[model samples]
Target: MRVLVVEDDQFHASYLQDTLAEALPEVTEIFHASDGAEGEEEARQGGIEAVVMDLQMDRRNGIEAARTIWAERPQSRILFWSNYADEAYLRGIARIVPEDSAYGYVLKTASRDRLRLALRAVLVEGQIMVDREIHRLQKQGAAPRNRLDDSEFGVLLDLALGLPDKLIAERRGMSLRTVQNRLLSLYDKLGVTVDPEDEAVSLNKRVRALNRALVTRTINVETLEAAQRDLDAWLGGRG
Candidate 1:
């Protein structure tokens, strides 16, 4: 089997190549790319049956590279080995993968045997494999009702961008009351408590929720960057 390993760290890339050679004797050839942009370019060259990718990279992230790679070749399997189980990565992965596609998300800390199993599951068996730790994190992150549904998140995003409720409602196609309620739900989910004693100097729960999300990584720089790009495109279209 021909496989591509997309990792910025040279040492890790080499290690992965060696491991693949040992674990899967059928993996006759392995290609390497140092970063996501290079990975995308290599993938575009074709003939790659599967890919082992690192989630975070300097220029273009693994998600972006995977999106383009899958767009070009939907049947290509991918295995992501990363140090983090960040919600942003999970959400990004969820958005790009084709329905019923074979993919894996395993952490770097996983045992070599586990990694081997995941690699085989994705590349050979054509199955989905998610590390136990990552699965736990995904469930924990999703368990909260107020973890902000799409509409609530939309309100929070608009609030983070310093938009008023009226503007947020207009932008999201929600009523002003609905927007306010969603913002309240978001604040609750984010643990942004209102201080009744300081009614005269009330804290801005919206700002608090945004800050909490940023610090906890329920939201991150990438989310804001994507939102900004979307806003810019919307504004451009309006013009």
Candidate 2:
């Protein structure tokens, strides 16, 4: 597989390239570009089997790059990787390849293993690996706000990771009540203006949605597209 990586951050770009090389040795060569502008140039030149690009870049940005690449090389698959679930990231992807085909998206923090799995699945299996975090957060619903200090954030993430409050307290040195109070605050920030009437019902819906998304190897492409464009506008200072 010939891989094209487009990212602006120097460290992250190198790390991504190295991760792919170490894990996917079957890949014959890797082509790297600094930002969306150069990425578009490289894409126009062709021969790329897959593209792993940052959705945000200095000059042109990932969305524009993907749009350009798609116009030039429709056969080439793209495995988008980014840190954000923000709007800019979504819209960047919305413009390119219809979600029915060989394209994938994974978050930046996804383990090297998941990244490789997503890449192989797309390049070989013709499927997408929606980031597990996407499933995890979407399962519980978005946090109303990210007000947790690092410690509180850790506790919140513990909930996302399915740790019980008692265990979390034992692990983090907080009392069980303290843990519960913090969680209530976290839920408040997450925008639950009303009390949760049915944890079971909400959990059931989330479980089914996430499971279907994974097993079907698909995702909310439409939502992602809309969000990305909105984020871009904000980042661009329009909002």
Candidate 3:
């Protein structure tokens, strides 16, 4: 099987290549791309049956690159190898993956045997493999009682970025009232909803909600950083 490894770190890339060569005899040929943009291009050129994608990369992130690759080739198997099991990364992957495609999410800290197992499961066996920690976060995030839909998550990102309701509405192309409503929904899901008659009313619901989210690990520094990048891009386009 021909495989492509997309990683920004040359050392890690070389190590992965060597490991695959030594361990997985099925991986006869391995290609390397240093960043997500190059990775997407390489995958698009065809002949790569599987990809070992790093979640974070310069120019483009793994989620964006994988989305494009899957758009062109829905059957392509991808095993996400990353140091982080951030909810943002998981959500991004969950949002774009083709329903019938096989995929895997294995952490960088995984044992060599586990990595080999994940690669075989995704590439050869056409099975899904998610790291245990990542799977726990996935289940927690998808729980019905506290689940945040896509729109709600978008607003939450804007809130975490300290964007006011008016600015959020402007950025999201919604009315101020709609933005406020979404905030209320976000607060509800985060379990930070405040009652007007209660002493908690003195606290800012937005701040409270963000704090709760951070404490629960629903959103982390990486998620906020990704949001900031998207916001910067949006602002750049406007200018």
Top-TM-score candidate index = 1
Q: Per-residue lDDT of 1-239 in model 2, one digit per residue for the tens? A: 78889988989889888888877777898899999889988877757778887876666667767777777777777878877654324433544575475777788888888887887887656775567775565445434353335555455445544467886786668999998887666554443343378555444322343343323223233333433454455447733
Candidate 3's error at 28, in angstroms?
A: 2.2
Which candidate number has the best lDDT?
A: 3
TM-score of 1: 0.85
Q: Worst ten-residue run, lDDT, model 1?
A: 221-230
Q: Candidate 1 at residue 157, lDDT?
A: 65
Candidate 1, residue 70: lDDT: 92
Q: Per TM-score, what order, best first?
A: 1, 3, 2
- The clash numbers for all candidates, in the given order, read 0, 15, 0
User: Which scores higher on TM-score, 2 or 3?
Assistant: 3
Q: Which portions of model 2 miss their true places by more than 4 Å? A: 91-95, 139-239
Off by over 4 Å in 1: 138-146, 157-173, 199-202, 230-239
TM-score of each: 0.85, 0.56, 0.72
Candidate 2 global TM-score: 0.56
